[model samples]
Target chain A: MFRERLAQDAARIQKQFDLVLGALSDVDVTQAMSYATQGGKRLRGFLVLESARMHQVDIDRAIWPATGIEALHAYSLVHDDLPCMDDDDLRRGRPTVHMKWDEGTAVLAGDALHTLAFELCTRPEVGTADIRADLALTLAQASGAQGMVLGQALDIAAETAASPLTLSEITRLQAGKTGALIEWSAGAGARLAQADPAPLRQYAQALGLAFQIADDILDVEGDAEKAGKRLQKDARAGKATFVSLLGLDAAKARASELVDEACAALTGYGASAETLKDAARFVISRDS
Target chain B: MFRERLAQDAARIQKQFDLVLGALSDVDVTQAMSYATQGGKRLRGFLVLESARMHQVDIDRAIWPATGIEALHAYSLVHDDLPCMDDDDLRRGRPTVHMKWDEGTAVLAGDALHTLAFELCTRPEVGTADIRADLALTLAQASGAQGMVLGQALDIAAETAASPLTLSEITRLQAGKTGALIEWSAGAGARLAQADPAPLRQYAQALGLAFQIADDILDVEGDAEKAGKRLQKDARAGKATFVSLLGLDAAKARASELVDEACAALTGYGASAETLKDAARFVISRDS
Candidate 1:
């Protein structure tokens, strides 16, 4: 069920991106944006659409935040692929933005996509003005200095640090890096509906950690071709990750436990949240 | 008189920057954000506050977008100074963010500041939700692919082009690169008041063009010590600019004429808009 929904959401989100960016005169940047945003699992968008459905919100309003999160996520990936950062040549099975065009284009395209995220949230079709403002504000909190960027900074800092990060430290870093946006996407529907976001927030917190644990496991044992990007980089750099810190078996067990906890948090929504349950389960099981 | 008001506005705006960024936990990025934002002319910020004042808007609400524009502008400068971009070492007489910190921090700090711009605009203190959404939406329009980023991309493309840009090409580039933000800042007050932004748009279009023409003039004749960053970069690269397209004498005359036109657009505001008139005149006259 979640697989079909995820594919549909991805197509719908891509169409919305086309509608938002198709008219831009900077075809190179917009084209790069489309490429970067394409082929993601659309887990964030699915989380947004499903959460909105659970809240009885319209798909029209939900698509705004859904697409916004994906754009924001895509921008992060583009920047992270820069020479000074991840320095990766391939992403999503193709040349990264910097590799395809140039570093300057990648930077500008990433910045433009980042700006587009907020623009989408502010669309009148999203919801009331207040809800739009809330979406923009929360997005800033999730993606800014204290959130995703902070996590990136910490990750960078670890490269030169005298010692590897402990389990707790890596947890905090992953919470900021991978968890913040997931939590925001999951809670966006409740924000639009002016309902309590607590349950979704709890579910997302566990799901995000589980997602990262699964990623660490993949980096340890998954196929490089299936991943479509660099893997086992933590081992290459002698960096500590969940798999390194917890052992592969322990990491897998922890991920399974977190998925259970994530689903348990959705008890109030009953069967309506089963897709989200599937999503949480899929996060741990996805090969890529 | 305008100098003193501009100085006060810069100081007040800087204080707001401190307030907004101080609460952030990522000290390194926040520090870089502050350093990049400091000691500039604050011309864009002053336009926002002065325009808001012209609309009889309170300073409390006005400062949000005022500071927001400055943050957005600062982010552009930070990224533009990167090694993959302009590769500048100095900005505002201080080492660039990448020089002071590292490329990773510079990238994250710029991203954070860009996010902060929208976050500030969404402040409840700024105005009604509709107004805040308008600010965010317009800001995205002014700064995204078809606006500032588009301009930067063109400028980058110009570096390797077989031929120099024509006068009209440079004009279109400058309009997107510099004119868009100035137009947005100058028209912000009217947006907040739900007034027609037409006159300020006309005024800013002329002012922004005039401002770039003056910058070209400065690159030819101004003191680098006063400018605080590299000057004559266009000439050094053999690139076409306003002064190259038009003779020095003709360019100066054209800028002065633009100042007059920009001032004339404010006839609807009477004496209340004298500061803006002074700003138009100052854009061409200032050394930095």
Candidate 2:
């Protein structure tokens, strides 16, 4: 049931992206934005929709922020895949934005997508103006220098540091890099509902960390074809990862523990949050 | 008086940037963001503040969107200066962000500043929730694919085209590239005050076109040292510009005419708009 719901949510998010980008001129940058936003797992959007479902927010309202988060995520991926950053040629089994087009198109497309995120958030259909402002504000915080960008800068700095980052440093980096967005996604429903987000935030904190650990484990054991991109690059680069810090078995164990904690955090919502708990478990078990 | 007001507003915007970026970790991206935002004409911010003053908005409330526009402008400049983009090495008489730091740092810094723009717009001090959302929504529209990004992409595509852009085509391109943000800045005060923005919008349309024409004229006639960056590159690259399309004499005459139109648009405000008229005159007359 959860897998089916996730698939449905992903399709919905893709449709939202189509609706948004289709309004743009058929230029290279707009086309690149449409291309880059396609084929993601849409986990962030799912978290938003599912959490919104639990909060009983209208799908009409929820979809805006769901699409917004996905757009922001796509922007980050497009920029991260640039030659100056990760330098990856493939993403989701296709050419990266900068590889498919020129770097200038990629940069502009990413930037447009970044603005699209806030644009979607502020759409009147999303809710009262206050809700829209709150969403845009929190998103800026999650994605800006204090959050995702800071994490990325730290990651780049770590690559050239004299020694491998300590486990705590790696955790901090991952929190900013990935955890911030995930937490924001999870908390969106409550923000939209104007309810307390403590439980959802707690759930996402564990789930995001577990997600990263699972990613590290996948780099070690998952098939390159299944992941649809390069694998084990961290190990090759001598970058510290969860698996690098803890033994592989211990890392797996920790991820499982995090999943358990994630599930526990959803106790307040009881069976209504079962799918979200399943999402937590799936984070560690998914091959991709 | 207009020059002094512009200088005062520029310093205020700079201080706001310092306060915002100062809260972040002393990382390369944050430092690069500071450097990139350090110097500029601050014309957009000045427009925001000056228009806000005309509308009787308080400085504390007005400063947010003023700073927001400047941050957005800085983001555009940083990205435009990248090796993959315009490839210029000097800006404001200093090394470009990418030249000062690595490309990754520059990219991240630009991205952070882009987010910071929205963050500033959504601040509580900016206005009520609806007004803040309005500012962010309009900003996203002005800076996104339909506006600034579209202009930039067209400019990039024009580089490799078999023929240079025609007068009408370049006019449309500049409307998106530079005119959108200028219009937004000029209208911000009216938006913040919930007043009609039509007059300010008209004023800015003329002002922005005049500003671009002046830039083209300066590129041909001004000193590189005074311009604080490379000049005459448009002519060298065989790129179509106002001066190329209209000739130096015609371009200057057109700019002067636009400044007159700009000042005429401000007649609704009577003597209160004298400074804005001076601004329009300064747009065409300034050395840099």
Candidate 3:
């Protein structure tokens, strides 16, 4: 049942994504953009479309913003793969952009992708000027220095330290680095859905935390091939993880609890909430 | 006299710029924040404030966007100074950030600055959500792949080639690389001023071209000490320049013509246009 739903969602969004990716055709740029975007689970885009559907928001109106979220996600990965940051040579079983090309191209590719994301969201045809502005502001808040950048900064600082990080420290780091984007993804969908924002914010916060915990669990239990990058990279880097702090079983339990909270936040929306519920489940159950 | 007016404009905007830069600092982000933005000519900020003043707009209302433009300018310089781009070792007679820190930190610093620029502009106090959104869209258009990025792309393409680019090609390159930001700086200030955009855009286009020609002339004739970069780097890189394609005297004549055209755009505004007139002269006549 879950597989069917996931496949349906992917088919609906994948064509548009491919088209958008096609627009970036400089060989080096396309290569780097593909490396950053191609292998992802497409979870964020799913949330965008799913949440919009749950509220009966027009899917056509939502596609551009959804793509914008994914593009921003792709750009973040390109920079994260750089030797100065995670320094990982591989992603999704292929060489990272920096490894395949050079750091310079990787930098430019990420910069281009970042700008492209905004341009995509702000297209006059996407929605009202106000909606475009709202989307841009939300995305910028989540992706900018105050949000993802700060998280990455903390992640880097933690990497070089000898001492283990406290639980709160780890939460704070992930909240910015991983959680912020997830929150933005769901929030963007909700905004497009024109749902009441009070409940939407609640749903996003729970969903984001749940997603991060599931990722932590994957880092511990997933196979290297299936995970698409090196397993145990977080541990090797001496970065903190929920599994390290909570133990594997407890981490799994925590993820389950967060997912439950995420689902409960949608109680007011009833049947319309099915896709988001499935998306929450997918975050925990994925191999990668 | 022009220097005195420029100095006054610089002094007025510098205080606001400093305040915006200070607000960016927190305990964790201060080091990178300072490293990315501590010193520069602040030319873009001046344009923002000066343009706003020309229309009798409130300077306070103009400061945020002005600072945002300056931040964008600083971020571009940081990236341009990297090893893969202009490969400069010095910026403003000081060691470039990449030299002062490691390459990775330099990369992150640039990214942070870029994100910070948008964050600053979109702050609630800057303007109405609509105005902020407009500013964000304008800056993104000016700075992103279609604008500065395309120029940089052409620049990288030109770097390794033996062929001399035509004057039109060179103009397109500058239009994207240097001209976009200058144009946006004026446009942004005009937006703050609530000036009629049709005329402002025309003025900005001429000013942007004039600024590039001045830069090209400076590369040929300015002293290395004042330029704070290698005077012959453009020629060595096989990069097209106004001086290279138009010859020294022709480039000088063309630059003057552009400045005159730029100044002429402000004629209808009468005495309110003095600073802009001085700015046009300063662009071509500056030693650095």
Candidate 4:
């Protein structure tokens, strides 16, 4: 049920993204931006909309933040795929922005998308002034130096470190790299509704870690074809990952535990949160 | 007097920026971000503060947006200096982010700083939620595809075009690439005070063009040491710049006309806008 809902939400967000880019001139950067935003699982958007549904927040207002988060995610991917970064050539089974167009287009497209996220967050229809302000502020925090970017920096440094990262260090890195944005996506509804975000925050925290572990597990075991991009590259690079530190079985077990914690954190929402709980469980089972 | 005031404001903004980055633990990205942001003229920051002062907006509140614009400008410069972009090796007489910290660090640092600009925009202490929302939304419009990014993409596309850019094409590109952010900075004061931004907007439209023209003039004739970056490269590349298209004399006359128009836009503010008018005049005379 949750899987289908997530797919549906992803499709809806795709339309939202189209609207955002519809009026843009047919330039390389705009085309690259539109292409970069397409075909993602949009798990973050799903979290935002689902969390909003749980809080009885209107879908109209929720859509902007949902689309915004996904755009931010897409920007991250586009930049990560640059030759100067992870240097990946493919994303979502197609050539990345840098590979398809050029590095300059990719960089500028990612940057435009980055600013677009905040612009969407500040849309007058998103919510009240306070909510808009809060959303923009938190989105910045989630994606900025102390969050995803910091994590990327640490991940890069770890590769060249004299010693391999410890289990805890990997955990810390993943939390920033993957957890921050997920947490922000999950908390969107509570922020929009002006409700207490503690429960949703807890759920997202656990879900984020579980999602990273699942990614590591996939890199170790999943087929690259199904993943739509490179896999097993972490181990090949000799970098410490969740699987490296915990071993396969222990990593799998830890992910399961986190999924359980994620679900339990949503108990306050009762049956309304079943989809989120299912989503948490789905994190470990999905092939991609 | 205006020059000294701009310099003082630049110093104050530099201190504020330091406060933003000082607490982060040592990391490649953090260091790269700091390096990228250092030693700029802080012209945009000066615009924000001076504009805000024109409307009696508190400096305390104005400083956030002022600092935010500088950070955004710094991020643009960092990415602009990427090997796949401008391929520059020095900025403000210091090593470029990619040169000093590697491409990956430069990319991530620029990304983090980009997000930091929005984070600072939504700062609670900056203004009411309405004001913050307005700033964030307008900033996105100014810096995104329809604004600075579009300008950058156009500039890149121009490099390999079969023909050099026409005078009108160059004007349009400059409006986006350089004009958008400057206009936004100039309007910051009006936005903060919720006053009429029309006059300031008109002023900025003229001032921004004059500023770009001055830059082109400097590229043709200024000392590289004072400029702190490479110059005359545009002519070497055979790119059609303002100076190239209009001829040196015509470009100078056009710039003087723009300064006059910029000053004229300040008539609504009377004596309070004398500094801004002086700023307009200074654009054509500065060595760097």
Q: If chain B of candidate 3 is superposed on the true chain B, what is its TM-score?
A: 0.92
Ranking of all predicted structures according to DockQ, beginning with the best and ending with the worst: 2, 4, 1, 3
The lDDT of each candidate is 0.91, 0.94, 0.75, 0.92
Off by over 4 Å in 3: A1-14, A17-27, A193-195, B1-30, B193-195
TM-score of chain A of each: 0.98, 0.99, 0.93, 0.99
Tell me the chain A TM-score of model 1.
0.98
Question: lDDT of model 2 at residue B169?
Answer: 91
- Model 4 clashing residue pairs (backbone): none
Docking category of candidate 2: high
Ranking of predictions according to TM-score:
2, 4, 1, 3
Angstrom error of the Cα, residue A165, model 1: value is: 1.4
Two-chain complex of model 3, DockQ on C-alpha atoms against the true structure: 0.49
Native-to-model Cα distance after best TM-score fit, residue B257 in candidate 1, in Å: 0.9
Highest lDDT against the true fold, candidate? 2
Per-residue alpha-carbon lDDT of candidate 3 for residues B1-288, written as tens digits (9 for 90 to 100): 556755665666567656655664252443655656655667777777777777677777777777777777777888788887678898887788888876666776777777767766677766776677777778888887668877877777676668878899889888888888878887676676455655656677787888888888888778989877778778777677888888889988998898888888878878877777787888888888
Worst 10 residues of 4 chain A by lDDT: A19-28
By DockQ, the better pick of 2 and 4 is 2
Docking class of 4: high
Q: What's the TM-score of candidate 4 when only chain A is evaluated?
A: 0.99
Top candidate when judged by DockQ against the true structure = 2
Give stretches of model 2 more than 4 Å off: none
Comparing 1 and 2 on DockQ, the stronger one: 2
